[model samples]
Target: MPMDERTRAEVERAEAALVEHYPRLVRLAYLVLPPSMGRHRKVLTAHGLVQRALPWRAPRRPAGALPAQRGADPGAGYDLVRQRTVELALAYEERQRPAVLLPTVPFVWGLRLFPRAGGADELALDQALSAVPAAVRAALGLWQLEGLDADAARAVLVRAGVADPEAAQRAAGQVDRRTAGTAALLNSGEFDPCTVQARPTDLLRRRQRVRATAVLAAVLVAGTVAVAALPGGPPATGPVPTAAQQALDPARLLRTPHEQWAETSRVDFTAWPPRGRQAGDRQLLARALRVWAAPPPGTRIVAAADTSTRPPAAPPRLLYAGLIDNVMVVVLHDGERLVRYAEPEGATPTLHFARVDAADLTSAGGLVIGRGNGWLRYLIAPWVSDVAVRDLLAPEAPPHGLHLAPDGVTDRIPLPPADGVPCGHWPATQFRSSPRIDDRRSFLVTDLGDLAPVHLTYLPSPGAGGPGEATGTPALHSWARTACTLRSLRGTGVRAVNNWAYAQQDLPEGGGTATWVCNRADTWRGPGRAVVQFLPPATGPADPGKTAGRARGTAACSPFGRHVLGDVHWQAKSGKWYLLAAGSSEVAGIDVTGGVRAGAAAATLAVPAGPQAPVRVAGRLGDGRSLLALRP
Candidate 1:
């Protein structure tokens, strides 16, 4: 049973590539697999699937190829391997749990009860997918994760035994509905596997152990030969630990609070930016108070306080300790600030603090602490101890600061300039007019000694120019009026604009309205330059005569249409002008100006145009709703 030289080489190559792409494969598996499987199992399953599907043979290269092209291309090969692996895993799932007819009432109710408490959109999506039928889930995974089109996705489903085209289309539609607001989140690279920590090596070891265990069990059951008995049989099962025993265990201390007062134990404060050697416990207490008070106004503070005098060997330094609302708040504060941390149960504790507030305190009674000028009194649980506090903080450096880019009409914290200037202060403003061309908008300069400007945009009053309006221009003009009107549509329940193009408006009547507007004024010129049209809901019959034309590039008129026409732009890559478009569901780019009716999906337009020529492209959907974009 020895392996041949070729097979050994192939296995080595496959292992190397898999090791490099392990994280990505795990993330892909997390998305495609059902949430009920949990993180560890999902990672293990993904590793197994990827291992089985890898093309272990050395890649074939054309003769006379350069040295650079001689070896196997892991990146190119990975995509195919990953796709095949997901398809196979899904197929296996389908076979394991074949489609079954369930009672309609209970099935609908079960969908409602599915868990939906995941903090991130990606996690929420995984939970949502659990409620979806297996066939529908497969369809969605193929489209969302694999970037397959409806037709391609349908073909895959059909091959998997979902023979009916309508059923496949219905599954695709269900995916579109369930993942409406989360499509971008699912496609983003910021996935966080909360509890799963298995690596490729771990998976390999687990597989080997499982095989060994199976062989041992089979041998024992068969009793083919009289085997020498070991010293002892399987270990005896012990009774469950009592409440007292559980309370004493350090691991269970955080979850279960003890009523009996135990001697307070002190441990070394290990958080970085170590507290000054001379700093006393009182000073540490004050520092913790400051952090609690510094959070932006309206932030609720939850904290615990401990005044026990019992000191154990190497007691935790009072780096930062305070009581905000009575729950004892203690952290291994660096000399300057509380160490940033996070701790998920069962994983190694980290130094990052969770965003805790008054609502989080479980204690009923309040506590009193003397502050500089007055006594600080707040309600917090007394059960939280120093040991629990240590468990709460994650032991890691702070994540990168989040910088929210400014939307047209909101005050935003400006990011620091490249010169390492600090953001100073931005005075609150009541109302500010949109920026007009040639007119300077007032800026709030930070006081951090840096001249960083935080721009504030407020809702325009009755007569104020629209958001981003050009200055020194007459307000009652053609395109300007249209812009103003579009802005005014916000009053009609158009809460926000998606990609600055599509507006979802709720009608005064029952059904909602989806409008596509051309926000770009400089390039829009033809007869129907600023296209604003209503899109049909996805529940009704398709509208006739809604085809790709000069006025409408790609529009959907079907009930399932939820298309948005992204801004059209030309990119020169490899000496060809590539038109790019993006939207919900599916987007197709059509070369209307070139008189070509054929359409290509949203990522990149199929037609190649000259750089000098103006490209007029339309984004269309399967149901026939279209929006024309002219980039001159």
Candidate 2:
């Protein structure tokens, strides 16, 4: 049935706010549920319920605050939505497959966990809600449902003769009595989802074991229902406990015999090859275990995927790669691990092997896609940077310049052609041809390629926008003669264009502009500050004009990787440069830094954490020290 104008308008308002907050809310719901619970199932089901119960329409333009819910608790709106949703769901449950039951209203709450709604606390929320009783549930559903104004609802109640405040209060006490009637079902105002449900389950053992198991079969049921009530807060995954406040000082680990060989491939210390799951309780693929820890140098080496070198075979599985930058992982999966590897032994490397890839090669690591695809096809030579190097060579120019762009980093600014600059022109060279050093880190070895003083000019930030939006390109142009190399550093932003590292930023009220980077020496400045090489540009829409971007007071700079990044969001608040680095593990940090010696300090932010997040993810739970989740 078409919703009435009033309901439609209310839904539209709620929906707008909902859509804005959905991503975080859904993620939070899932976190509370745990992957094993199939949070996906609950999410799909809940969203479906919302669609049917509260269809929305275009809202009439309203100047300000929504119709107030006088005398109604803040949760009243959602409770109404929940009640309506449940009615629809229960009717359909007869025909639907058995699935996890979820709360219809998702007003994510976790006071302490603002800006985030995931990780461990979600689990607690889940446990707490599962303990809600029938009466409490009814009260919760009726009161928190969406779109009902308190006065209107109260008027309806008055008409229904449910009684005035005094009478209603008397009736509420009976449900309250039942709510905490059982020891297992304590009506503690404070919630503890996990334990709450567990107590009920325990009670069922003496009464109805079979019934208990049948009722809460799906994990999502416990997860969603329990967590749906609380405000989503600090990411539970939080950061890894600070690593003893000390650097690995790699020098300590017994130096492997093949240091040169290891460096050749960029030995990644955290090379997790895609998670290998062996739920059968059997040994995980032996080859996987073997590769988990680097081989003891002297052990007999086998093939890349060969499983024979190692013994027991287990089910093969995909592994998550945990690799450090500038480290090549020399994986010899002891014959057994190879069970999962596909082998076409006779195959040969095509003259032009496939291209464009990423594998945790840097600190600000994520997927860095080089924007220009057509540029490569159009170039006369099938190469990245058109530079030439002989025997041992160093990375000079963009592609070879360990940058985040399609090419590593682009040394766009030529430090001005010097009197004795080699070739005196930045020549075109391919990354493959460069001589590498410390884990793909190599110097611009003299023999690598011919010196070409390539003067590639570019307009600065706010490239093509009109008026005040006209943030120009890097005005400070440099002439490159000798080996122009780039060493990838860290920075912030989302996709290549959305990234701040390679873009420009304008000051508020159209003050001045600052480009994303400033490269000095071979090393690139990082986390979106300092001088760094530019990645080669591929054709795309010209950057938004500084004026266009700055209108909202944010300058388009670097695009974020997985986390969202934008000038409007990050820039407006702090005129200073910020780096949205994969600060640590899954943890994304907002920080600022200067030149090489510059130390980075975390910026106050509100991001959630996960099981695999980094250290310093959240400022120490209560103390200055971070809190790590340990299974009790």
Per-candidate TM vs. native?
Answer: 0.27, 0.21
> What does candidate 2's lDDT look like per residue over 1-632, in tens digits?
23543444456545554455344223222222211112223344445454444454534546785753343343433434433444443332213322333343333321111122222222233333333322232232233322234455444344323335334333334333423332222222222222111111122122333544665585456787757756676655523422211111111112223233224354222232232122121222232333332232112222211012222222222222111122111112221132121111232110000111121122112111111211111111111223322211112223333232221223222222221233323323223222232232211211110011111122233333221110122221221211232211111111111122334334343434433332221111122221222222213222212211111112212222211122211233334433222121222224322221112233223222222332222222222443221110
TM-score of 1: 0.27
For residues 1-632, could you state the per-residue lDDT of candidate 1 as single tens digits? 11332243444545565677666555555566554343334444555665555654544445895433224655544544554555655653422421221111111111112112232344445444655555666666566666778877676566546657567557556656645455566555434332333223223334545766997898788674435555478864655754333322323312111222121221111211122222234443443333332332212222111111111112222332333222333443221122222122332222222111111111111111111121122111232221101000111211122221111111122222211122121111111212221122321111111111111112122123233322112211112222222221111111111112233333222334432333321111111112332332433222211111112222222112234344332333245553333343354444345533346544234344454545456667566767554332
Q: Pick the candidate with the highest lDDT.
A: 1
**CA shift at 630, candidate 2, in angstroms?**
48
* Model 2 C-alpha lDDT versus the unseen true structure: 0.26
Model 2 residue 142 CA deviation in Å:
9.7
Deviating ranges (above 4 Å) for candidate 1: 1-26, 55-83, 91-120, 160-169, 189-632
With candidate 1 superimposed using the best TM-score fit, by how many Å does residue 282's alpha carbon deviate from the native?
52
